[model samples]
Target: MPTYAYRCRECTETFELNRPMSESSAPADCPEGHQDTVKLLTTVALTGSAIGPAASAPSGGCCGGGCCS
Candidate 1:
């Protein structure tokens, strides 16, 4: 299953849904009686060394040894 983000053009509402790949692109109506909803891009969870800025950088000494012992 993948998580999809959706935006309702009629009601200007945003929501998320966990759906199968086959049905992930299906059009969905807003729960608030708005029918002009559109599916946004799907998102994936990142893990391990791909998490943040520090995780992406080398376990370094310093910038030109400025603050390094």
Candidate 2:
């Protein structure tokens, strides 16, 4: 299952939901019973050495990666 982030336009509330990839575009309801919501773009975190395609990626920040230097 993949976690999807959504935001409610009515209440301006944000939340996450776990669903199958097939329903990735499915609308999510907010906790406040708001049906007008849209999915928000989310990022995944990878914990490992800079390898493969991510190797050429730039550093995120000072605390990013294993080294603080």
Candidate 3:
């Protein structure tokens, strides 16, 4: 199962759904009965140093012990 994010255009409401990949997206409606919803692109988080130090440090100050000095 994968989690997907959806946004309702009518009400500008956002919500998350967890379902099987085989399942098709439903026309999600807002609590107020608005019916303009669209599925959003799902984002997966990288784990275990896959992003590396450069991604962790935006200032580039900690590389090669520059920050410590």
Best by TM-score: 2
Candidate 3 RMSD computed on C-alpha atoms after optimal superposition onto the true structure: 9.0
What is the per-residue lDDT of model 2 for residues 16-45, given as tens digits with 9 covering 90 to 100?
999999999977889999999999998999
What does candidate 3's lDDT look like per residue over 14-49, in tens digits? 887777877647566666677788889877986775
Return the lDDT, model 2, position 36. 97
Answer with 1 or 3, whichever has the higher TM-score.
Answer: 1
Error of 2 at 62 (Å): 35
Q: Which is better, 2 or 3, measured by TM-score?
A: 2
lDDT of each: 0.77, 0.87, 0.73
What TM-score fits each model?
0.58, 0.66, 0.55
**Which of the two, 2 or 3, has more lDDT?**
2
Q: Taking the tens digit of each residue's C-alpha lDDT, what string does model 1 give over 1-69?
A: 777888999778998877888997688778787878898865577776745555455455667554887
Error of 1 at 6 (Å): 0.5
Q: lDDT: which is higher, 1 or 2?
A: 2
